[model samples]
Target: MDKQTSRNLWRITAGQRLRYASAIAVTGLASAFMLSVPLVGGYVLDVVDTQDLAQGAALLVEAANTLAVEIGGKPYVAYLVLSAVAGVGLTALGATCQYLQGRWAAIASEALARRLRETMYERMQHLPASFFDEADTGDLVQRCSSDVETVRVFLSSQVVQIGRSILLLSVLTPILFARDARLASLALVLMPFIIAGAYYFFAKVREQFKITDESEGALTARLQENLTGIRVVRAFARQAYEVEHFGSKSLALRDNRERLNRLSGAYWAVSDFLCTAQVCIVLIAGGMFLAAGSLSVGELFAFMMQVTMVIWPVRHLGQVLNESGKAMVSLGRINHVLLAEEESRDPAPATERVRGELVLENVTVEYEPDRPVLKDLSVHIPAGETVGIVGPPGAGKSTLIRLLARLYEPQHGRILIDGLDLLEVDRHWLRRQLGIVMQDPFLYSRTVADNLRVARADVNDTEMMAAAREAAVHDAIVGFPAGYRSRVGERGVTLSGGQRQRLALARALLVEPPILVLDDALSAVDTGTEGQIMAALERRRGRHTTIIIAHRLSSVRGADRILVLEQGRLIQEGTHATLAATSGPYRRLCEIQGALDEAIERDLKETSNAV
Candidate 1:
């Protein structure tokens, strides 16, 4: 399909068409039974037309006498009694058929909703992070849930109702024309105006419903943002400000709902008026024909029955149009996300082991072209080497770490694992070779073992404990009553900052990657705990390659090589002792931090003396 056509929600859910067609078939069957009622009534009236009142009374007396005989013994009388029983039986059959038709529609609606939600979630997982930056989470949630429900309602009701109405009209119109050509022609004259009015009102409703759905999305997003940030608002003393902001969003949504209500009211009022007027006209015209002795009393009665069938469908057409309008708008919104590009990568399956030699060659990255963050920067770390990167805030430290993981692509230049370029290698394979422990690591609301398994799914409990011991966090983990099975709460809110960071480090260690990157991961721990973790890391020196970015000078002091950055440029690359003794950004930074520490110690001592 062309891109323009691809955006339609109906395309992904084309199965719904078959579902609708099935419902239409059942509705047609039920409507046929109802149409038979009018035909039966007409046939009875025709029988009346053949006889005078005395003859008709004699015919009824004969039917009753036959039924009485059946109760006693006559076979023909039994047949007459059975005919009345069959008519009542057909009426009950028609009611059952109608109920089945509605039940089938409900099943179809529920099935479509389930299929659509699953497809939407799969699409979401594949979409790139850039897509989330542009879309609101709550709005996306609403589309997957509320918007799908709207379409389902239309599928269950409007779709089948329209089919039944058309079938009823088609069957009755011909019968009416056969009975009396003049009255049929008069009734047909009002049809074009009625159809035109329905189409116009439906178009108006469709336009309003689009705005209403959009307002709902915005309202849901606003409410979500407010609730998620409630703690921040309370801390900042912004309760009144937040309340007013939320109220404004709520008011806008309410106004949109009111607009829809007004349009809906106007539409039904006009439709009812037109239908009632048409019924009145048919009654008056038929009465005149009856007075002229041009039409028989029984024939006139049958014509009136046909007219009732015709107008009933016309009255229901408005309801069908209204529901269909709402469904169309909802489908458009839901399809918007389902049709979005699956932005994550998938490649050939990868193995369990990888060597960790990393190389960056003339790398350049930019969120937008002509404003590069890292320009023509290149570095290489052999397997099992420890390299420390020191830089001021916003010196592209995190950007470099992100490139190592392929979170994004560099605008120009290449990154490689061992000798194979990262782009050419399977992303899963490349990621498996490396582990990252970040400054503010994210943890799911799951057991400690559950979170650790994200790194390497096959790791057993014994292996997990060993990895935790290597990260110097085993004592802390076991200190909790539940131990490794303890819940972390959302984002690890239940854990202290130091404990969360230690858990993250242990998770990375569990993977046993050839390369490990610590992006200021030790910033949360105390000096003594930090020392122990570093000592544990030192014991694993030749077993894994490590890249460390540190704010604390002591953290990177043991690195075999140190790279210093200022802005996006690497200005110094040497051993820690060499950089501290020589002149450059690294030496200056060390001297400044050293003086600050001394001053803090002096102030503490003076405060103690005064006390």
Candidate 2:
């Protein structure tokens, strides 16, 4: 892992690191008891040996005499029983220690995962809107959930096992050498090979696991997109195309995972072979030593057991390297998100209440470098004035409103709200004062009343009903079987597009912000409903500033002033009648809309006569 990634991991889990250390310490004690088991069993075998029965076992007789002198003439059988009980007791003690180590490790690792997840999620919430525009939701979800779980597994299992294995090897190696240096050297002859193999495996496995992780993230993104847009796919009759696209990503993930698993399997197979060979070499060499009187049977047996302890951990070390390699890759991916720059906001307190006097002086914005959406645009709306903005498609209408709402900062010039620089204002405070209903409004799966009150949780039922009445959706809401308590499906799928838009408008109005911007919010509603909503808005004209961006000329005809824009430039500004009388873009748009409306009316009348 890189330094920053390691730092991030430690920063999140600093409180739990001590617990992890304690768990490792306990594991070491458990390993000590485990190592003693073989030595103790070897001693028991020596004591129980009955070769040359006529002579009566010398080792057993000696042990029995010692025990009898120490304990009121108890027989050797009593000594044997005590030795068996001691072995069992040691085993039980070791098991208890192992359990404690596992429990503590689990606690530490799980807590680390939880902390990391919470931090990542909180960071995501504060990220700028542009980040979400470019980021894949599925990939982010994968990082927050699956990737963190992978790290948890590494911390809980691989890390603990690695420490245990190293401790066992360190403690047992000297004992093996003390028993017989020549045999010990042979037992560890494969150490260099194991180290070299581990290094090679770490390098190769880390890269392979990175590829697998990225592939999985991409596959998840594709699946999420397909599911979220299932309606669009069906409407376009593109099920086959979507399925093929999804299948390709799925297969790529599978192939990468298979390759990673193959690499892991090959490494372990080689490691196991090397460890087994070392054990076999020690057994053969010790047998020869025993026959030559250089080693006793019991001693040789203990030496062989100790050699196994030293070599088996090498295999486990290989597995740890493999798992930890994957975890490091996951950690790196997570760090990328955690280290991303969050949305910048002024630290100064917002002591001024917004009066909704907005001014844009030569404002310019671009989603991409050198591709300006709005260029050198200037406009002003005094407090308590209702301004209508009309523009052609791609004329930066939405961009202009977004700038006023402080959702995006302009690359050039400045925006001022009540004579204060918009950039200097606290973002949260500014947003709370501006109520916006976009062309595409999002609704949660909730009741009508709940959706209406989302912008202002403190709003009472009467306030919600009043806002719903202003949006001309009150009757529609109460007409439902369960009234305001009825559930709207995901994204308001159960409601019509027009109904969803009106509910969004109601939600914005319920907050009663000092500034309200409707970016084609009433486009989905019928002309009758739109008229009712506009009339209701007129009643609150001087109470707050309102900016309406609409394609329908009728929606803005009664505005205090209408601004016509084309190609991100304000081409005309006047009352609707004055703009209609002039020979300009506004006049042209009015003429075109008139012709379209006449044609629609004629068609409807002809259809009625035929019926």
Candidate 3:
């Protein structure tokens, strides 16, 4: 694996320290059992050489004979009873041990996965909105789902199983040497060559697997983007284009997999051939020793059995190497997400109520240093005063409001609330004092009541209904099949444009903050409804400091003061009537709206005459 990916794998696996050790113990025990079997068989063979071969045979016969006579000549029945009892007991013990080991492995894998996801989510929550702008949603989903599953599978399936195999090899190899030094030494000569080949293959496999994982993540991202923007795609007739893009990503992933498989296959085939050659040499040498009277028939039989036990675990040594490579791949994918930079915020303190005077002093924002969105702009909103902000497209109106909310910090100057610099204050405390209603509001896929509750969870049903009534959405909500409990569907798609706008207004009202911002919030409503909402806002004008950004003159007509912007600079500031009387950009906007209204009236008259 690449160094960066290797480091990430090490970090994630490090969290499973205890379970890893337990896994080692369980695997070791299993390996030991496999290695011990041949030695036990050898011991039985030794008894034939030392004691009378007939006596050795007679022990089994005698036990059978005694049981048969006791049961009226059933020799087969006697043997069955003896073998069944021993087999059942041994099987139960082995099964119990294996089950516990499996459970430990599962616990380790799940626990590690949970911790990794939690850490990633915590980071995501803190990261700035800009981070989401730069990142792909589908790639994030893949990291949490398929990539995580890959890591879990390695832990439960490959890592622990490979450990067991190695343990068995270690236990069996020594026994073979102790039985006969010459034969044992001969078998071990092939070990270094096998180990070297395994490591070389492991390096290649790790690289290929990492590429495969990245390609898969990219494919997921492409599919998700296509589905989410399917409307645009169909409108443009780009179905074939999307399919081709998705197909390319999939093909890349498949090629990586095939490459890894080829490398793994080569390693296994070589290891298998070497093992077969080793076994043949052992059998030929053992036969010669027996013929020369240097080894008895029983001794030769035992040696052969021990040699048979050693091959699987020796092969397992290579398998373990393979598993390690895959684990490394999964670890890298998860780590990349964990390492991505998170959003920055000031540490919060205990609750502190805000006195709503907002000040922006010579503030400037440059997304890139040479190109400033807002340049040395300064403005103030007095407590309990309502101000309207009127600006043309790309006039930095939205950027100004965002800075006041501390969603984006000004790079060149400071923003203050009640004369204190905003940077020094806690983020949560600052947010508690401000409420924003955007042009396009966000709603959860939940009930109307639940969405309102997000602003203030302790709000009662009576208070909730009151907010809805003030926003003029109460009657429509009550008419729904489930009333306030009706599901809004994803992003409140079930609600009409006007209804959704009012629901968002209701939600903002529930927060009850000292400062309120309305950024073209009433744009979706009819003129009559807009007038009614403005009248309600005017009644509470002196109770809260309100900032409204609008292009429509009628919406901002009731404000105490209006600020007009051109390009990214504030060009005019006064009451609506005062600004309208003076020839400027604000007057031009009013003229545009008047002409549009007159054109609509003429169209309606022409349609009536034709009818």
Candidate 4:
């Protein structure tokens, strides 16, 4: 891993590095204890075959003499039994260490995965709106889930195996040379080639892993979109087309995955061949040393056993290096989200409630360069005044409210809420002070009461119902199978379009924000129902600063002042009576809507008369 990647991993592994450190120590201890088994076997063979306790090294001779009690057919029998016990005991201790190593690795990896998930979720919550606008929901979900799993697998398995490979080499190489330096050199001649080949394969496959990850992400993103819009797909009878598109994404993912697997297969094949060749070379050379009477058969056996230990780990490392590449790529993808700049947060969020006085001075905004959405727009709505904003589509109506909520900063001028710059006030605090209901509002797949209570934690049942009643959605909610306990299915599909909007409106009202914005939020309701909700809002007059953005003039006909927008500029501003009497966009819209309504009314009457 590079220094930056290692640093990111260390940062994420906070509070759990000690556990990993312990696992590493345990792995080393396990390797040392387990490696002693071959030596014990070699020592017993030497003593039994030669029928002398002094045939092998002086250390074993002295230890065997001390450990063995004579209850023997031959002198070495008691020593043989003692050797069995020693070998079993060492193996058991090593196994125990192995178990501890696995447990610690698992615990640490799980903790890291949990922390990764929580950090991603919290950071996403604070990320600026533009991040979501440019990010795919499915790709982000995969990063949080699949990418975390990839890293977890690496942490739990590959990380410890890597430490084991290093320990095996560092500890065993010295022992091999100590036993017989000349033979040990021959045994290790092919080992460097194995490691070099593993890394060379690693370098080749890293880019392929990244490509496979991207393909999988794209597949999931397309799948998520199709599932979310299943209704739309079925409504348009586009199942075949959608299925074909999904198949293509799946095929791309499959092809990329197969390519990655091919590369892995080639690595394993070459590494396996190299490992076998090294083992054969060590054995052939040990036989030559034995023929020259310099190497004992028992010692040769021990050398073969230890060389196997070293050779297998070299191959094991090749497999782990592949996992390391994927883990590194996943870490990079996840870190991107964790490092992206979050929405602005004030060190000390404004604690005082805003008076809702809003001022826009020569405010210019643009989503794209040189193409302003709201151009030099200036307006002021004092506290407790009811204002209406109306414009055709793409006239910057929604942009204006978002600016007031501080979702986006103005490029040319500043917005003030109660004499404080929008940027100066905390973004979270400003949003809480403004209750906004969009045209197609979203509802959670939860109980009606839960969704309503989500807006204000302190809102009791009584307050919730009152707000719902004001939005004219209380009766509909009560009519559900379980009343307030009834669950609204995903995105509120259980309710009509108008109910979703009104329920969202009720949620906003529960906040009792000083600034209430209804951005064409009543388009789905009939005029009669809109009138009932508007009448309820009327009772709130002079108590809240209300701005209603509506395409239907009737929704905003009674406001104190109406502002009409054309393109990105404010072209007209007045009350209903004043604007209607004048010839401008407002009057032209009223005339066009009036003629359409008359035509619809006549058609209905003629059809009823014929019946």
1-611: candidate 2 lDDT, tens digit per residue: 56866676668678988888889999998888878877766665655563322222355456666778888765656556655776788889999999999999999999889989998999987787778888899999889988999999998878889888888888888888887899989988988898788878988999999999998899889988888789999999999999898899989989998999889888988888888888888889888998898876667777887788788887788788888889989998898788888878776445546788989899889988988888898888999999999999998999887787677899999998888888987788788778999888999999877787688889888988899899998899999999999998888988988999999999999878899999999889899999999999999988889999999998899899998888777889999999999998899999999999999999999999999
CA-lDDT, candidates in order? 0.80, 0.85, 0.78, 0.90
- Candidate 4 overall lDDT versus native: 0.90
TM-score between candidate 3 and the true structure: 0.86
Q: Model 4, which residues run further than 4 Å from truth?
A: 56-73, 347-351
For model 4 the local lDDT of residue 197 reads 92
Residue 174 deviation, candidate 2, in Å? 2.7
Show the colliding residue pairs in model 3.
Answer: 31-168, 126-343, 127-343, 128-343
The parts of candidate 3 lying over 4 Å away from their true place are: 1-16, 45-92, 162-172, 234-241, 263-267, 270-311, 349-351
Better of 3 and 4 by lDDT: 4
Tens digits of per-residue lDDT for model 4 on 1-611? 79999999889888988988899899999988888899889988887777778765565555556655333244466567667888899899999999999999999999999999999999998998789989899999889999999999999988889989988989899989999898789888988899999998897788899999988899889989988899999999999999999999999999999999999999999999999999999889899989999988789988899989988998999889988999999999999999999887875344567778999999999999999999999999999889999989999999998888777889999988888888887777788788999999999999999889889978899999999999999999999999999999998889999999999999999998999999999999998889999999999997789999999999999899999998889999999999999999999999999999999999999999999
For model 1, state the Cα shift of residue 248 in Å: 1.3
The per-residue C-alpha lDDT of model 2 at residue 306 equals 75
Candidate 3 lDDT over 1-611, as tens digits, reads 57776567667777686887787786566444444444434434554456532323344446767889987966644544544444455455556667778888989888888877887777777777677777788888888888788778887767777667666566767877887887777766777777787788788878887787778888889988987678779999999998998899889989887887898888889888877777777778878877887876766676776666666466766777776787777776677667776545566645476668888888898777788888888888889888999887888999888888777888988998888788887776888888899988888999999999989999999999988988888999999999999999877878987888889998998987899899988888888888878887887877789998887889888898998876677889999899888998888888899899999999999999999
Off by over 4 Å in 1: 1-10, 14-19, 42-69, 72-88, 169-171, 294-308, 312-315, 344-346, 349-352, 603-611
Please name the candidate that would achieve the greatest TM-score relative to the true structure: 4
Q: By lDDT, who's the top model here?
A: 4
